[model samples]
Target: MTRRVPARDVVVFTRLFATMIGAGLPLVQSLNILGRQTEHRGFRRVIRGMVRDVESGETLSGAMGRHRRVFSELSVSMVAAGEAAGALDTILGRLADFLEQHGALARKVRAALIYPAMIFAVTVPAVAILLVFVIPTFESMFASAGVPLPAPTRLVIAASAVVQGYWWALLGAVPLPALAVRRALGTSRGRLFMDRLMLSVPILGGLLRRAAVSRFTRTLGTLVASGVSILQGLEVTARTAGNRVIHDAVMSSRAAIERGETIARPLEESGVFTPMVVRMVEVGEQTGALDEMLTRVADFYEQEVDTALEALIAMVEPAMIVVLGVVVGGMIVAMYLPIFEMITAV
Candidate 1:
C-alpha cells in the first residue's frame, strides 16, 4: 500500500523518538507509541512495520536497516551499537541532533537559491512581454509614422519577428540538448570527469568541496563513535558520502585500512583531500581519538560550508543583477538605437 509522507511530521518523529528514549521507555513500547501517534499515513505505516519487527524479536537496528532510505547507515549503525551497549537513548539523541543539523543546512541552501530563482522567473516574463508584444507595437508606430528607421531599430524588429513567429522552435530545442547531456553524465567516466570539473569551478567548487568534507567527517565520526570497526566504518562512510569523487577516495582508503595501512596515507595518495584534513586525521589516529577528531573536522567543515554558502549567495545576488542588466539593457539599447539615429537625422 502506498503511504503518504509528510516532511514536517518526520521532524516530529525525531523529537518524539528522542523524548521517549530519554524517558527510559522500553524500545518496543516506544515504537508502538510512535506508530500510533503519527498522523501521516505513510510514516505511520513505516512505523507500524518497525513495531512489528521489534515485537517479532528483531532489534531496532535490524528494523531500521530494512528501511535504508528512511534510516541512514550512520543512524542504523549508531543505533545498533547503542543497542549492543545498552545505550540506545544516548545514540537516539545524537541521531536526532545530526538529522536536525542536516535539515538546517538543507534549508539554508534552499533559502539561498530562492532569491535568484524569483528574479529569473520575473525577468523571463518581462523580457517575453517586451519581445512578443511591446516591441512589436513600437515597431508598428515607427512604421506608420513614415519616419526613416535607424539600423538598430530595424534589426531588433526583425529579430523579434523571428522570436514571435517561431517561439515553439526555441522551446523544442531546450530539452533535447539537456537530455543528451544527462545521458552523457550517466556514465561512470563522464560522471567522474564532470565531478572533477565541478571541483575546479571557482566559487561553487569551494562550497561543494566543503560540503563533501562535512558529510564525510560527520558520517565517519558517527560510525566510529558507534563502535563499528574502522574498515567497516570507512565502507559505510564511502557509501553514504553524497559526492562520488570523495566516496571513491574513501573506498580506496577502506581497502588500505583493511590491509593494515593507515587511513591518511590512502587519502593523501588520492589527492582529493586537503593537507590540513589529512594531518588532522593522522593526528587523530596517533592519539587514539579518531572519532573525536572526525567530529571536530565535521564541525569545522560545517562552519566552512556555512561561510562559503553565505559568500556565494552574497556574490551571486549582484552577479545575477549585472547579468540581467547586461542582457535586458543591451536588448533595449539595441532596439532604441535606430530610433535615436533617425531622430538625429531629422
Candidate 2:
C-alpha cells in the first residue's frame, strides 16, 4: 500500500523546488509547477494547498506550517529563518541535504534489522511444516523396527508430536506477547523503558546511540546554521528525536539552558552523550561557532554510524544464514540419523 506522502517524495520535492526557486522562479509558480508535475497523490494535494496559501499572501513558512505531517517543524522553522534572512533557496537546499542524509542513515539501520527478521519469518513456517507433517511419515517405520531411536531422532519426534498436539497454543502464544509489548510501548513510561533497553544492548545499542546522536546534532546544527536559537533548536530536536530517552534528555537540556547552564553541561549530565560530544559542544559554545562545531560533531558521528552499521550488517548477514542452516539443516540431519545407523548395521 502507498503511504501518505512518503519521506523520499518529500526529499525529492524539497530538492526540486529548491532548484526552481534558486533559478529565480516565484514561490507560487514553483509550487504550482511542483503540484502539477508531482506523481504522489497526497503530496501533490499538499503542494496545491501550499500554492493556494502562498497566493493568499501567506509566507512560505506559514503555508508549509499548514501541512505539518508533510513538512516537519524543523523544516518549517528553517524556512521561516530563510524567509527572514531572504535566503529561501539556500535553506531549502540545506534542508534537502539533511533529509536525504538522515533518510539514508535510517534506511541502513532498517535494512540491518529487516534482513534477519525476513530470514526468520520465511524459515519459521518452513520448519514448522516439516516438523508437523513430513517428520511423522518416518515415525511409524522407525517405531516398527522396535529398535531404540537415537537421541537426536527422539528429540525430533517429540518436537513433531508437540507441534501436532499444541499447534494452536503455539500460534496463540506468538501474538499475545506482541500485543502486550505493543500496548506497553504505547505508554510514555514503557516507551522510555524500551528505548533505554535498546540503547543498552551490546554492539547494536552502541550503533543505535551513535545514530541518535548524529541525528540530534545534525538537526540542531542545521537549524542553528539557518539562524534558529539553541532553545528553539533543542525543542525541535526533542520533538523529532524518535527515541523517548533522547527526547527526554533534550528536553532536560532545554530546561537547563533556561536556568543559565551551558548547553553542553546539561547534555553531559544526561549520560547519553559521549565526552567527545560534550567537549565539542563546549568548544563551540566558547568559540561562538556553535553551529559549525555541531556540524563537525554530526559529521563525525554520522561517519561512525555508517561504519558501525556496515560492520554490523557484515557480521549479521552470515550469522543469520548460519542460524537458518542450523535450524533447518540440523533438524533434517537429526531426523535422518536413525536411518543412517540402520544402513550402517546392514
Candidate 3:
C-alpha cells in the first residue's frame, strides 16, 4: 500500500526537487539524493520507488502518478504540463508556493478555533462534575436541615440524580451525535444540504465562503498559468473544492464555457461568485489575462478571510466567557441561597 505523505513533506519535496533540477541535476540523481535525505521512513520508501521508476525510463510525472496517495491530481497535471513545456523546475517552484499557501490558510483557520475548543473541553467536564458529585452532597445537607429548598436548588438536585442514574447513556450521548453527523456527511444529498447550510450561517458563513472562493480561484489560476486548459483546470478544481456548493458552481461554469459562453456569466448566475469577482473575470477574459486576474481575486479574498476570522475570534471569546459565567455562576448562587436563609433565621 502507498503511504500517505503529509502536506508539509510534499511542500518540502517540491522545493528540494525544484532546486536540484534548477541546478542541472539529472532527474534520477535528484530523486536519489532526496530519497537518502528523507527522514520519514514511509516517505523515504516512496522516494526510493520513484527513483527506481525514473531509472527504468519513466517520466517524473508518470512515476509520481503511481503514488496517488502522495501526489494530488493538481500536482500530477502541473508536473505533466511542465515536462511537456521543458520548464519542470519553474513549475515545481510554483507548486511548492501553492502548497505552502494552502497549508498556511488551514493553519490560520484552525488557530482561530483552538481557544474556544479548549474552553469547551475544560468547561464541559467541570460542569458535569458539579452536577454529578458536588450538588448531591449539598442536597443531603439541605435535606437533613429540613429547610425548604428554592425551585432552582431543587431543579439542580433533580438534574444530579438523573445524571447519576444514567451516566452510561450520558457518556454515549457525546459521541453518538458526532457519529451520526459523520455518517450523514458520507452521503451526497447530506453533503449538499450541509454545504448549503454552511454558506447560510451567520458570521462563520462569510468566512467559509471567502475561504472557498480564495481556494477555488488560486487553484484554477495556478493550473491555468501552468499551461493546463481552462476546462481541465475547472474539472480538477471542482473535485478539490471541499464544498459541494462551490464544486457544483464550477461544474456549471465549465459546462457553459464548453458551449462558448463567458466564464463570468455562469458563475454570476450560480450566485456563488461576488459581483467584484464576476466583473474582474470579465475584464480578464477581455484583456487575455484571465489567469492573472484570478490570482488577484484570490489575493483579495485571502485577506478577507484573515480579517473575517479575526473579527470572529474577537466576538466569540467574549460570548463564550459570558455563557460560561452565567451557567456556572448561576449554579453556585442557587446552591448557597438556602444556607444564607438558614443563617439569617438563627
Candidate 4:
C-alpha cells in the first residue's frame, strides 16, 4: 500500500480539508470523505489510515506523524498548534497557501533544468554515434583515396579510432562515476562537499543559492506564523534544507538564538545570507514581526530565482546549440576538406 504522494495532491487535500473543517464537519467524517474523493490511490489510503487513527482516539498530529513521508514536520507542527488553539481550519488554510508557493518554486527550478537535460541527452549519443560509426567510414574512404588528411580530419579520425577501439571503456566511463557519486552522496561528509561544490558553480549556483534561501525563509516563516516555536521551526527547516551548507547556517543561527544572540548575527557571520537579508532580519526581530519579514524575504528571493533561471536558460540554449554545431559540423567539414581539395586539383 506504499506509493509516493505528490505535492500537488497534498495541496489540494489541504485546501479541501480546511474548507471542510471551517464548515464544522466532524474530523473523522471530513477525513473519510476526502480520502474517498482523492484521485491518488496511495494518498487516499494514507488519509483513510489517518481517519482510522482518529477514530481510535489518536490525535490528528499523532496520526500525521506516523505518515511522515506524506506529512512534513512543519505541517504536523502547524496542525498540532491549530488543534491546541482551536483554529485548525485557519491554520490549514495558511498551510495550503505556504505549500502552493513552495511547490511553485520547486516547479520553476525543475522546469529550468529540463532544457539543459534534454540537450545533454541528445548531444551525447549523437556525437558518440558519429565518432564510433560514421566517422570511420569517411576515414577509410579518405585513406583509400591516398589524400593526406588535414589536422582537423586527422584529429577526428584519431577520436573515432579511440571511440571504436575502447567503446567498452567509454561505456564504463559514464556509469561508474555516476555510481561512485551516488555512493558518496549517501554520506553526510560527501553530501556536504557536493553541496559546497554546487554552491560554488557559476550561473546555476546563484539560482541554487537563491532557491535555497527562498525555501528556508518560506518554511521558517510559515512555521513561525503558525505558532510553532522558533527553535523547533529552525530544527524542521534544517531537515528540509537540501543543501548541507545552508543547513549548517540555519542550525548555527538556532544555536545563536539559544545563546541569547541575534538570529541575524550568526547568519551574517556564516556568509550564506546577504547583508540586506541580515538587516531586514534584524529589523524584524526589533519590530517583533520576524515571520512577516521572513515571508517578504522569501518572496523576493523566489523572484530572484525565477529571473536567474530564465537568464541562465536563455544563455544555455544558444550555448548548447553552438557546441553541438561545432562538434558535429566541424567533423562533417573536416571529412569534406579532402573532397574540396580533390575537386580543385581536377
Q: For each candidate, give its TM-score against the true structure.
A: 0.92, 0.95, 0.97, 0.97
Better of 1 and 3 by lDDT: 3
Task: Name the 10 consecutive residues with the lowest summed lDDT in model 4.
Answer: 265-274
Error of 1 at 91 (Å): 1.3
What digit string (tens of lDDT, one per residue) describes model 1 on residues 19-46?
8988988877888898888777777788
Q: Whole-model lDDT for model 3 versus the true structure?
A: 0.91
Better of 2 and 3 by lDDT: 3
Per-model lDDT? 0.82, 0.90, 0.91, 0.90
What's the lDDT for candidate 2? 0.90
Order the candidate numbers by lDDT, best to worst: 3, 2, 4, 1
TM-score of 3: 0.97
| Model 2, span 93-113: residue lDDT tens | 999999999999888878878
Candidate 1 off by > 4 Å: 1-8, 142-155
lDDT of 1: 0.82
lDDT of 3 by residue, 141-237 (tens): 9999999998989888888898899999888898998888788799999899889999989988889999999999999999989988899999999
In model 2, state the lDDT of residue 66.
Answer: 87
lDDT of 4 by residue, 139-253 (tens): 8888898998889889989999998899899888989889988998999999988988898898767788888888998989888888889999898999888889989999999
- Where model 3 places Cα greater than 4 Å from the true spot, the runs are none
